[model samples]
Target: MLSKLFSELKRLPRYAILLAALTALGMTAGLYRLYAGLGATTNMSKVFPWGVWISFDLTTVALSGGAFTLAALVYVFHMHDLHAATRPTVLFGLLGYSSVLVILFFDLGRWDRFWHFIVYPNINSALFEVSWCIAIYSIILIYEFSPVIVERFGNNRLLEWIKKLTIPMVIAGITLSSMHQSSLGTLFIVMSPRLHPLWHSMLLPVFFLLSSIPAGISLIIIGSIVSDMLFGHSLSQRVLEKLGWLMPWFLGLYLALKLGELLVTEELGLLFSSGKYSLLFWLELVVGVIVPMILFSIKSVRWNRWGTLTAAMLVAAGIVLNRFDATWFAILPRQGVTYSPHWLELALLVGVASGVLLVFTILSTYFPVFVETMPTRKPQEAAVEAGRAERAPALSGD
Candidate 1:
C-alpha cells in the first residue's frame, strides 16, 4: 500500500513531490523529537525559552506585515495602483503566519496547554496582546484569502459575501497587525538588563514597528519577482517601480529612528566598539538598512527587475538575521553560553519553511494568486466596475 502510494505521488509534478518528501521528513523528525522531549532533543531551558523557534516566529510575523501594509495601501490609503499586488501579498502573509503558529506550537514549553491564553487572561502581558492579535489577524488572513478559492470554484454567491467583507477585513487586519507586530518587540523590553547595551532601549517597540514596514515592503517585492519567475507571469512594471520607489522612504525613516535611538540613548560609542554585538549592529544597519537604501534609491537598480530582486533578498535576509541575532546573541552576549540549534532542530525549521514554500507553490498553482495567474475579478467587484462604467459616460456628458 505504501509502495503504491509512493508510485501515485511520483505521478505528480516534481515540485509537489519534492515538497511532499520534505514536509513528510520534517514532520516525521518533529514528531520523534517531540516524543523524545525538548530537554532530550534540543538546547532549550528556563532562561532561553525564546530560542530559534522564537527567532523564526518573530521574523515570519514581521514579514507577514506585507499583508496588512499592502491592504492599508490599497484600501485605506486609496492606492488602487497597488491593487494588482494585494492578493499575492495576502497569500504570502497567510502562509507565513499560519506556518509560524505551527512552529510556535512546538516552541512554547507547555505545548498541550496552548489554550491557556484564551481561558486564563493576562491583561498586562505583552505576549497576551501578541497572542490575541496573531489569532485575530490570522483569521482575517484566512477570510481575506478565501475569496480566491471561492472565485476559483465559481461560487458567485459565496464570492459576493466575501467581497462585501473585504474592506472590513483589510481594516481589521491592519489594526491587529499594527498592535502585534510591535508587541513582539515589546516582549523583549523587560530584558533591558539582560539585553546587550546596543539593543537595549525603551523604544524597541518603535524600532520593531518601523523596521517591519520596509521588511514587509521588501517581502512583497521579492514575492512579485518569484511569482514572475516561477509562474511565467509578470506584474505591472509601474507597480514594481512604485513599490521600489516607496521602499527607500520607509527604510530612511527606520534608519533615522534607529540612529536617533542610539544618539538619545547615548550609545554611539557602543556602535563603534569591536564587540560581537557591535559587529552585528553594523551588519544590520550597513548591509540590511544602508545597502538596501542605496540600492532602492538608485534609479537603475530600483527600476530593473533583477536589481530590485537582489535588493529585496538583502532586505529580507537582513531582517531575519537581525531578529535572530537580537533574540539569541544580543539578548545575552556576556552570559558565556553559546546556543546553537541542534541539527534536527534546524532540519525542522527547514522542513517547516519547505512546507510553507510547498503550500505557496501549490496554492499559487491551483488558485489564482497572481494578477496574471487569474485575471478575473470577484463578481461584486466586476459589477461595481461595470456600474461605474455605465455612469462614467453620463456623468462626463452632464
Candidate 2:
C-alpha cells in the first residue's frame, strides 16, 4: 500500500514543482500583506472594506455548492448516474471552501484578532453565523473527501472508518452549506438602504441559492473539460451530457425569478437606464445569462464541447458579476463610494488562485481524480494495447 501510494506521488513531479513555486509566492505576498496592514498594501478603504478577497471568496464558495448538489442527487434522489463525478467534485469543493477561509484571514482588518470570531461567539451577529457555518462546512468537505484518499492509499481500516462517517457528514454538509450560502446574501441585508432598489429585495437569499446551482454545475462542466484536455481522458460523457440537460432548467428558473422580482418590484426599467450600474446589470443579464441560455437552447450547440465550454465560462463570469453587483457595485453608488484593488490586493488574489490551481494539479496527477481510462475512447484501441503486450512476451522469452 505504501509502495503504491509512493509510486503515485512519484509520477507527479511537474505538479509538485508548480505547487512549490505557488506556495513560495503566496506565502511571501501573504506575509508582506500581514506585516504592512491592509491600508498599507491593499486598495481597501472605509468605504470599501471588502475588495478582491471578498469577491473571490463569494464566487469560489458559491461554485463549491456543486458538492452539496451532487451529494443530494446521489444520496437523496438516488441518481447513481452522477456517482462517478462525485469524488472530483468533492475534492474541488474542499479546496474551494478552504481557499475562501484562507482569504478571509487576509481580509480582516485585525488578522491576529480573527480568533475572536470563534472565541467571543456573537450569537446575534450574521457575520458570526456565516463564519461558523463556513468553518464547519469546510470540515464537512474534508471528511467527505477523505474516503478517496483512504481508498487510494489502501488503508482498509481508515477507509472503513470514513465510510461509516459519510452519511452524517453528508447531512452536515447540506445543512451548513444551506445556511452560509443564504447568509452570504444576508450579509447585504443590513446595507439595504445603501443598495439600489432593483437589487435590494428581501429575496436576495433565494436569488443567491438559485444562482448557485447553475454556477456550481457550470464549474463542474468546465473542470471536466480541462481534465480531459490536459490528461488525455474523459471522466464521464454521459454525466456531462446529462449536466447539459440540467443547465437549462436551472437557468430558466433563475431567470424567471429575477424577472419576476423585477416585475413585482416595478424595477424592470432599470435594465436600460444609463449608468455604470445599469451597464453592469445589462452585462450580467446579457452576457452572463441571456447569451448562454440562447446558445445552450440549441441541442447541437449544447452537446458541442466548445459551446459547452463557452456557456460554462459565461455562467461562471455571470455569477461573479452577480455577486459583485450584489455586494459591492450595487451598494457603492448609494454610499457615494468606489474602490479599485491596489497592486498588493491584486497580487494576493493572484497568489491565492495560483495556490488553488497548484494544489488541484498535484492532486489530479497523483490521485484517481480523472478516470483511469477514457470513457469515450474506442474499445478496439484498448484491445490493440492488450494484444501488443501479449506478443511482446516472445522477446522476453528469447
Candidate 3:
C-alpha cells in the first residue's frame, strides 16, 4: 500500500505537488486554529467581527454563481450550444461552495454547532437564508453533476433516470442560487451605519446579484481556458464569445444601479471626496467592471482567447475586491480597533483554495468533468424518450 501510494504521488506534476504541500500545511494550521479557538488564532475582535474568511466566503459564492447562471442559459433559456460549458462550471461551483462551507465552519466560534441553523431556522435573517440556500444548492450541484459519474460507469438506465430529474433540479438550483446571491448583499444591509457610504445602499442585494452575473460568466470563461491548458478541454471560441457578450449588459446594469443609488441617497458627492474609499471603489469598478465590460463588448477581444481570459480575470478579481471592500475595508472601524489576518488565517485560506484546485484537477482527470464525455441528451429529448418508453410498454400489452 505504501509503495502504491508513493507511485501515485510520483505521477503528480510539480505544481500539483506544490498545491498538495500548501494544502497539507494549511490543513495543519486550520486544525491548530480549531484547537486554539478563534481568539488565539484569529485577529477578529468585537468591533472587527468579520475577517478575511467572510470576505472570501462572499466572493466565492458570487463567483460560483456560474453554476446556476449557465444552467439558466442552457436549460431555462434553451441555449443548447452552451451545454458543453455547464459541466465544468458546475464542478467549479460545487468546489467553490464546498470551500465556502469549510471556511464558514472554521470561522464559527462554536464550529461544532454549525449545523444548528438546520434545526433552528431564522426566517427573517439574510444570513439564515444564505446558509440554507448554499447548503441545499450544494446538494443540487451534486445531483446536477451525478450524470457524469453515472455515464462514467456506463449506467444508461440510471443515467436516464437522473436526466429525467435534470430540468426540475436545474430550476430549483437556479432559484436557490438567485436567493442567496442577492441575500449575501442583504447580509450587509443592517451594517449601513458601519459600512462606508460609497459601498452601502438599499439596493445592495440587487448590485450583488447583478455583479454576480458577470463574475460567474467571467469565471466560466477563465475556467474554460484553464481546462484547455491543463486538460485539453476547450469550449469553442463562438460559445466563449457568447458568454463574454453577457458581461457588459450585467456590468452596465450594475453600474447604473450603483450610481443611481448614490444619486438618490445623495452619496454621489462621496465618490471623489471619500479619499481611500473612493479609490477602492473606483479600483473595483474600472479594473473589474469598466475595462472588462469594454473588452467583452468588442467583437475581436471576445473572440480572442487570451483577451477574453484577461478580461475575465479582471472581472473575477474585481468582484473579489468588491466583496472585501464591503465586508472589511469599507467598514468604519471602531476607535483603535483594526484588523488583519493572522498567519494561520492566511495559511488556511491558501490551503483551502489550493485544495479546491487540486481536487478539481483530479476530478476532471478521472471523472469526465469536461464536456466531451458528459451526457448529451437534451431535456426535451429525454422527456420524449421517456414518454415513448412508457407508451410502447402499454401499447405492447394491447
Candidate 4:
C-alpha cells in the first residue's frame, strides 16, 4: 500500500513539481504569519476577521459540490450514461476539499489552539459543526476515491474491502456534503444585520444549496474540457451533449430563484440603486449568470466546444464572485469596514491555487482517469474495412 501510494505520487507531472514549489513557498510564508502573527502578513483586523482565505475556501468547497451532483445523477437518478464523469468529479472534489482544509489551518489565528475545536466538542456552534463536517467529509471523500487507487494498483484484497465499504462511504459523503454545504451559508446567518439586505435572508442556506448545484456542474464541465485538451482525448460527446442540456435548466432555475429573492425582499431596486455594489451585482448576474445561461440555452452553442467551455468558465467565475460578494463586500460594509488582503495573503492565495492545478495535472497524467471503453463496431463494417486494406495490398503486389 505504501509503495502504491508513493508510485501514485511519483506519477505527478512537472507542473505538480511547480505546484509543490509554490505550496512550499506559501507554507513558509504561512508559517511566518502564524509564528510572527497575523499583523505581519495578513490585512485582517478584528472587524474584518475573514478575508481572502475564508472567501476562497468557502467558494472552492461549495463548488466542489460537483462530486455529489454527479453522484446523485448517476447513483440516484439512474443516469448511468454520465458514469464517465464520476471518477474525475470525485477526484476534483477531493482536491478542492483538501485545499479548503489547508486554508482553514492557515486562517486560524490560534493555530496551536486548533485542536480545541476537535478535542473539546462544541456541538452548539455552527462553526464547530461546519469544521467537523468539513474534516469528516474530507475523509469520506478520500475513502470514496480509494477504490480507484486500489483498482489501479491491482490490489484485489484492498479493492474487495473498499467495495464492501463503498455504499457506507457514499452515504456518509452525501450526508456530510448536504450538511456542510448548507452550514456554510448558515455561518453567515448570525451575522444577520451585518449582511446586505439583498443577501440577508433565512433562505440563505437554501440558496447556497441551489447555487452549488450549478457551480458543481459547471466545474465538471470545465474540468472535462481541460482534461480533454491536456490529455489529447475526446470525452464522450454524448455525455457532453447531455450535460449541455442539463446545465441550462439549472442555470435558469438559479436565475429565477435569485430574481425571485430580489423581488420578494423588495431589493430589486438595489440592482440599479446600490452604485458600486450594484455594478458588482450586475456583473455577477450578467457576465457570470446571464451570458452563460444564454450561451448554454442554445443547442447550437452548447454543441460547440468553445462555446460550451466559455459558458462553463463564466458560470464558475460567477459562482466565485457571488460568494465573494456575499461574504466580503455585502457583509463587511454593513459593519462599517472594508477589507483588503495584504501582499502575503494574496501570494498565499495564488500558491494554494497553483498547488491545486499542479495536483490535478499530476493525477490526470498517471491515472486511468480519462480512459473509457469504446463500443464495438458491427462485423460487416469491420470486414469491409479489412477488405479495403486487402485490396490495397493486392494492388501493390500487381
Most accurate candidate by lDDT: 3
The residue-level lDDT of candidate 4 at 340 comes to 85
Model 1 quality (TM-score): 0.89
Candidate 4: stretches off by over 4 Å: 1-13, 334-336, 373-398
Please estimate how well model 3 matches the true structure, expressed as its whole-model Cα lDDT: 0.86
TM-score of each: 0.89, 0.88, 0.91, 0.86
lDDT of each: 0.79, 0.77, 0.86, 0.77
Q: lDDT at 366 for candidate 2? A: 60
Worst 10 residues of 2 by lDDT: 389-398
Write candidate 3's Cα lDDT for 1-398 as tens digits: 99987765554434666678989999999999999999999999999998999999999999998999999999999998999898899999999999999999999989999999999998999999999999999999999988878888999999999999999999999999889999999998998889998988889899998888888998899878765544545788888999998889999988888888999989889989999999999999899889998998999999898999999999999999999999998999889788888988999999999999888866765577775522234546533433233222232221
Global CA lDDT computed for model 1? 0.79
lDDT (10s digit) by residue, model 4, range 198-283: 77777777778777888998888877765543444445656777777787788778788888988988889988887878888888
Per-residue CA lDDT of model 2 for 172-258, tens digit only, reads: 888888888888887777887677776777788888887888888888887777655444445566677677777888888888888
Ten-residue segment with the worst summed lDDT in candidate 4? 389-398
Measured with C-alpha atoms, the lDDT of residue 47 in candidate 2 is 74
lDDT of 1 by residue, 1-398 (tens): 99987654443335555666888888887887878888877787666756788888899988878888889988999988888888788888999998898898877667899989998988889999999999999899999889889889999998887899888888889889889988988988888777887877788888888788888988988777655444544566668788889888888888898889889888899987848788998899888988988998999887798899888888888898878876886777346666777777777887898898778866765677774433244556543433333222222121
Residue 10 of candidate 4: its Cα lDDT?
A: 56
